[model samples]
Structure formats: C-alpha cells, structure tokens
Target: MATPVRVTRLCRLVGRTVSSPSARHRQAVSLPARTCFISTTTWKNLLFKLDERTAHSSLDLFKKDTGVIYRMLGLDPTHVQDNPERFRDWAVVFGNERISSGRHYWEVTIKKSQEFRLGVAEAAMSRDDCVGTNRCSWVFSYAQRKWFAMTNGKTVPVTLVGKPDRVGILLDYEAGLLGLVDIENPRIIHAFKAQFKAPLCPAFGLWDGELLTHSGLEEPEGLK
Candidate 1:
C-alpha cells in the first residue's frame, strides 16, 4: 500500500468539517467511512504495484467489454451519455474502464472543465478513441469521426486515426470514463431556463447526485 502524502488540514467552517492538523499523522487515520471524495492528488502522491503485463492483459478485455469491470465495481453502467455542450460551459464527462490496483488506480488530472459524454463503444470503436494526452483533456465524437483537444473551455478539432493504441488507452485513463450517467446538472442556463426557472423548479441549491458522503460508501442521492 502506498503511504498518503501529508493531507492538508482545513479549518472548520460553519458549514464545513476539517481534519485536525495532527490527524495527518494518526496511524489508521479515521476518515469518513462512507465517502468517495478521494482526491486525485492522493493517487498521484502514492504508488502501487502495476506493470505493463497487467494493463496489457486487461486492455483487450476492457476494449471488448468494459461492463465486466463496471460490474466488478458493483455499478450498473448502462449506456447513458450526457452532452456537455448541450448544457454549455466547461462540462466534463467520463466513462469507466478497468484500471490498475491501489494508489494510482486511475490518474485523471482535468485542469479544464469537461463534460462526460461517451461510452465504451464510442471510445473503444473510434479510431480517435483517445484524443488528448494525459497532460491535458480532449473531446471525442465517435459517430462524427471527430476528436480534438479541449483546454480552458477552448476546443481544437483534430482527426487522428494514426496514433498508437497506447495513446487511446492513456487518453481514456486521463479522461475518466463516464462514471454515473444520470448524475448531472444542466450547466447551460438556456438548456433548462423555461423548465427549471418556474415555481416548480428543481432544487438548485445543492447538487443532487451520488457523491462521496461523510462516510466512504455509495448511497442514493448522496450527501447533501
């Protein structure tokens, strides 16, 4: 197991909970048991045992059937896609595939906002299945044979059927495969102005979805 980096301690705000500075050094530190709010930095800060053979063996299976991996996580990963552009702004979409074990199981550093919008079929089948390098984010449109770099909400379209398989796989890792499909908010004001602005507007205060709770487990309509 990889040792965690010194977790920064935050102050306890009226509406927030924070760790004591000493909590960082507590052996078997007590964190919320039912939460999934793991930081990406945590993964990068730690290391685990993963080699080329492990990833290579799983690549074919993931390319052929990612659902099996999804099932392993006990998540019902049906084909659900949400277009970020449809709602406007920096929308981020992701799809999940098998990743390495522990520590850096997945390394997704999305400096730019993204929209989760494709599926295994869309990602794996497309020649441009992978678009941008893990160094940055990218967009993919399987049907249109379109792929491009997405940074700072700016898009750069590209057509690359000539890249190596490593590019596609790594891109997929950098871009989290679509996690939970229905868990989303309409980012575009115009997308739902008429429908949501009325008296019957849906709760717009807190995001309503499956997010990490104070504890570290999955729950319906996660922590408020």
Candidate 2:
C-alpha cells in the first residue's frame, strides 16, 4: 500500500522573519535546474508587468494554530472572512484574468516570509489540488531551504546564487513556456516548456508565515 500522507492546514504565527543569508544560501545552492535551457537574453526580451487589479480575493494562510489572526495582503477587506476550519495542507489564490495566448508578465514582492509558491494554473483546476501536483498547474515552490519546479507530482530542483526579494513570472502560452525571473538582476531563475491545454490563471501559494504583495504592472523600460 502507498504511504499515507498527513494533511494539515497552511497556517503559522505572524511576525516571523527569514533573512539570514547563510540560511537562504544553504537551502538553495545544492538544487539542480529542472530545465537547462534558460537564457538571460530571452528573459530580457520577454519582460512584462503584473496586473494588480487581478489579485485574488482569498489566499491560503500557512499557520498551524487555530484562531490566529493574519492579514491577507492585496485582498479587499469586504471579501475577507474568518474560517478556522478551512486552513489545511496548502493555501492558494488565483489571478483574475485568464491567459489564452501571447506573452504576459507579472511581479510579486516577498516582504516578510521566506517561502512561497507561484505560477500558472488552469482555471478549471480543483481547489483541493495544490499547484504543481497536477498537469493543470505549473508551479515553482521555495521551501525547506530549496527551490524546485513541481508538475505532475514530480520535482525539478532549481539552483540560485541568492534569494530573491522580488520575483517575476512570464507566461508565453503560445510558445508553451513559463519562466521565473529574479527582478533585481533581471535574470532567469528557471523556465519550463509544457503543453498548456486550457486558459491559465496566475496563481499564488503561501506557507511558512510569509507575506506577498502584488506589484502592479509596469511596462518594461524600453517597451513603452
């Protein structure tokens, strides 16, 4: 019989910090790239900005204790609700618009938390299915002092020289490409080639008491 996996809510106490360079480096340095074809030139040419208005109303919080009050950044106050029973395993939120074609880009700022998962998911994906576990989602997750791409229940470890404070995502649905970029240096952290069958919504996942803020769209310096 397959080993049973225990599921727990994605909640944690607020105000914890993950800023030790030694810790970040120790976690990310040993992972190997899942995809080996990333090029810096390609990333610069495809730069696109995030559409902040599309930020999701609900996000999964990664806390273990019940009755813990936490803030959901980028969500409207009226839509926020308290649900102690709903926190479990993974917390996810979706971008408002769907990407059916063309190249689009967005950026997210990681302020307080050290670990997170971000990528694109099919609009029809089940709420119960965490991003990167199924064919419908293409996710890049950072946790346990490592970075990796998750898809079809498999992990492709990614290596990076430094931890990124801001992350940029590029979805070239027409070309079947998805990329993760480090916004400060503007370098490609990882990229994937997949056959995306349905319209994709930008997705976010939070665990480990991290705070993520959506930095609205900004035209690439030369694109405007």
- Clashing residue pairs in all predictions, respectively, total 23, 14
- Write model 2 residue lDDT over 1-224, tens digit each, in one string: 12323223232322222222342342211122223222334443332222222222334333221111134443443454423212122455555455666676777666555667789887656544567766788888777676777776667778876566777787778789888877776666688889988767777666545544443355243320
Which lDDT values do the candidates have, in the order given? 0.20, 0.55
Whole-structure CA lDDT of model 1: 0.20
Per-candidate TM vs. native?
0.21, 0.60
Which RMSD does model 2 reach against the true structure?
A: 13.6
Per-residue lDDT tens digits for candidate 1, residues 52-160, read: 1111111111222211111112211122222211111111122322222221211221111121212122212111112221112233322223333332223444344
TM-score of 1: 0.21
What is candidate 1's CA lDDT for residue 44? 41
State which candidate has the highest lDDT: 2
* TM-score attained by model 2: 0.60
Candidate 2 wrongly placed segments (more than 4 Å)? 1-89, 215-224
Best by TM-score: 2
* Span of ten consecutive residues with least summed lDDT in model 1: 198-207
